[model samples]
Target: MKKKSIVSMLVAFYLAFGVLFSSVSAKIQSEQAFDNKIVKRLKVNNIYNHIEALSKEPRVAGTEAEWKAVQYIKRQFDSYGYESELQPFTFIEYKAPTKVSVNVNGDTVAAAPFTYTPNGDVNGELDYIGLGTPDDIKGKDLTNKIALIKRGEITFGEKVINAANAGAKAVIIFNHLSGELNGTLGNVDNRFVPTIAMTKEQGDILVEKLNSGDVLSASITIAGSVIEEKTSHNVIAKKDVTHKQKDTNQVIVIGAHYDFVPTSPGANDDASGTAVTLELARVLAKVPTDTEIHFITFGAEELGLIGSNKYVDSLTDVEIDRIVGMFQLDMVGSKDAGELVMFTVDGEKNLVTDLSAAAGVRTGTPLTYGQEGRSDHVPFYYAGIPAALFIHSPTEPWYHTPEDSLDKISKEKLLETAKIVGSAAYQIARPDTPALERAKVAPKEVDYEKMTGGLK
Candidate 1:
């Protein structure tokens, strides 16, 4: 054939090959069969009930509630006939005083501790530092005075550091918007002042009086403080039988964060994830797999993903490479939340996404795939293993709010998600079939018209 003819032929072949693969792929069976007998044991509502009980109180790191939560998880794993281990590590524990309030011109105002701030009490002149910064603080008299800083222009930690360096007695960083302020001051352990953050409204009350030349004598007290050497734990459970895998040296990890913020119950935030992981453990224990499947519940996820970071660091490069995929379930039980989405770091294609999405498609409840890495998946993804966080986003209004209770869980969503993920996992794990090489193939975008020969 002539050179031009040959080039045209190659293009035609690729198009034909692509067309054929797309047509045949839809008909592929995702799994031979799910032992629903095993899956039914994973009652979604039972998991929600568990969430209902555990989330009754906040499980902040290094606290009594956190320990209680850990015990509960241990108990569940024990009942399921799995080997459970609690890996302990220490992190800074901030204990805020029972009540944090501000007195602007002797009028008490509402406020809360800035996450990780040191504990202290101080009464001094209210100085509006206007977003306190090292440069803006020059020639400012902050010694023995309270600095009322705004949120923005830098991290809260930087603001605290700048104020402390300028000899400010206490730091009050208010929210940029009008509402209650809650969040951390960063993970670094060097904060020196008793700093508290409040809503923009609360801070503006003080700011308004200051502008009016009111004697802004303020009393700032942070019931919260930082503690060094505080400990946290990761609860891990192994199924009764070993998993079956193509590569004997490999493993698939499924995990979720069990901690919740002080005000939020976190039923969907992660109770859903934890419950599902446990249930899967129960079902998969008997079914068996070639590779190991480790089910874990993580603590201190609300604390800057500290627990996950510690867990990941505990493993070496060889261990990391052995991890074929990590599936992170965060907020998987909310029906009002949008359709299921799988997120990865840098939005690149990876193994976890490949498995979950493919399984979702095959299960007939396809999830919208996108890139995200805010949950426990980050650590594994950073280590170069394929990892993804499974979540229902836009969450509920109750998210991070006190209203996120057990009733918010959606069994249908949970069951669907579990079935898809479980079956997808089974397709790879079933001892019946030789483990297929993780075909790193991007999913073909559906083209019904072309596949049906332009049928309407």
Candidate 2:
């Protein structure tokens, strides 16, 4: 053949391939849109009831209450006729002090213990250590003495660690301003000495006394600081078509953390998220879908995404790659919380956000996405699966506090988010069939400007 004729033939072949690929892709999307009937099945009342029951008491990780909450969630999944199991993992658990006290020269001083600081009762001479920086203790002898450090220019955790490294018997941190210091070391650390917080006024008095050459004898006590190995669980429930042999290897995971902070009912922090997960499982269980849907409730999220990380780590590379998408629900039903926002680890939209946003624009609310790394969605995103976190932003004042109770939960908010996520999840997990196509299910251009955290 002539060179010109060969070039023309190659061009024609390329055009034909492009057309065939486009046709197949369009058909797949149409089938994935599936049926819309399940969207209406997500009721606010059902979600609210689950929240009321789960958040009736604090469900702190590794506590008996948390175990009960996990079991309760497992039972709910089983009731939906889905196969469910409890996945357990262990981690170092840290608890803050119940009581902290400081006595200086027979006078009781107001004090609070920083979380994760080792429990200690020590009597030693008081020595003023400015700022508690490494430089402040480089040459000074803080050994056998209680180091009085002023807060500022660094984290409380750093100050405690610095003092302990300097051989201080105990560390006392005073507020940089005027209030009582309340802080945490962020995580459990064995190097932390007994650390306590006090007001500026008391700190100033001690500093003045030391300057005047007065040797002060001090005693510090911290109680209830605990470091122990404890187990937490991830509850997994699977829903798929009855004919398991015809099932696709692809799976969709919807998850939420069931554990809360210490003393908090977590009605909004995560009971809201868990409730929404349960409701979604209930509604989607009977829906016909070729892909498997896994409903998971993780524990130890407050302790740094432990459960979700474990769940993802347990998966084989094939299983991880098989995950089509993951939707993580968190803090989705607070009356005081802001509008629904989706978040991805790398600040980019994936199948989860794209589908959820499409459903939001169609049915309940308009969902927008930004970057966030503080939820169960993070593990899936790290594992290279399409995942996004569904949450209400500008979090309520009750967040992580005891005030996060049922009264602060909004049924309207719950229903709105449930509707948005439910519709979105169904669109992806729904059986791909030509008959399930709908005009309302197409993906639209996301308004990046309207998204929170400025997109990146």
Residue 16's lDDT within candidate 1 is 100
In the range 269-308, model 1's lDDT, one tens digit per residue, is 8888888887777777777676667888888888778889
Question: 1-456 in candidate 2: lDDT tens per residue?
Answer: 699999999999999989877775554344234425766676788899999999888998999999999889989999989879989999987767787888999999888888778888999999898998888878987788898999888888888788877778898888879877788878777777888888899899999999999999999988887789999999999886544554555678899999998888999989999999999899888777766788999999998999999999999887886787788999999999898999999999876786677667666477788999899998888888888998998789999899999999999998888777777667555554211111122234434322211222
Deviation from native of the Cα of residue 85 in model 1, angstroms? 0.4
Runs off by more than 4 Å, candidate 1: 1-27, 34-49, 52-58, 95-230, 239-247, 432-456
**lDDT score for residue 265 of model 1:** 70
lDDT of 2 at 118: 88
What TM-score goes with each of the models?
A: 0.69, 0.71
Model 1 worst lDDT window (10 residues): 447-456
lDDT of 1: 0.75
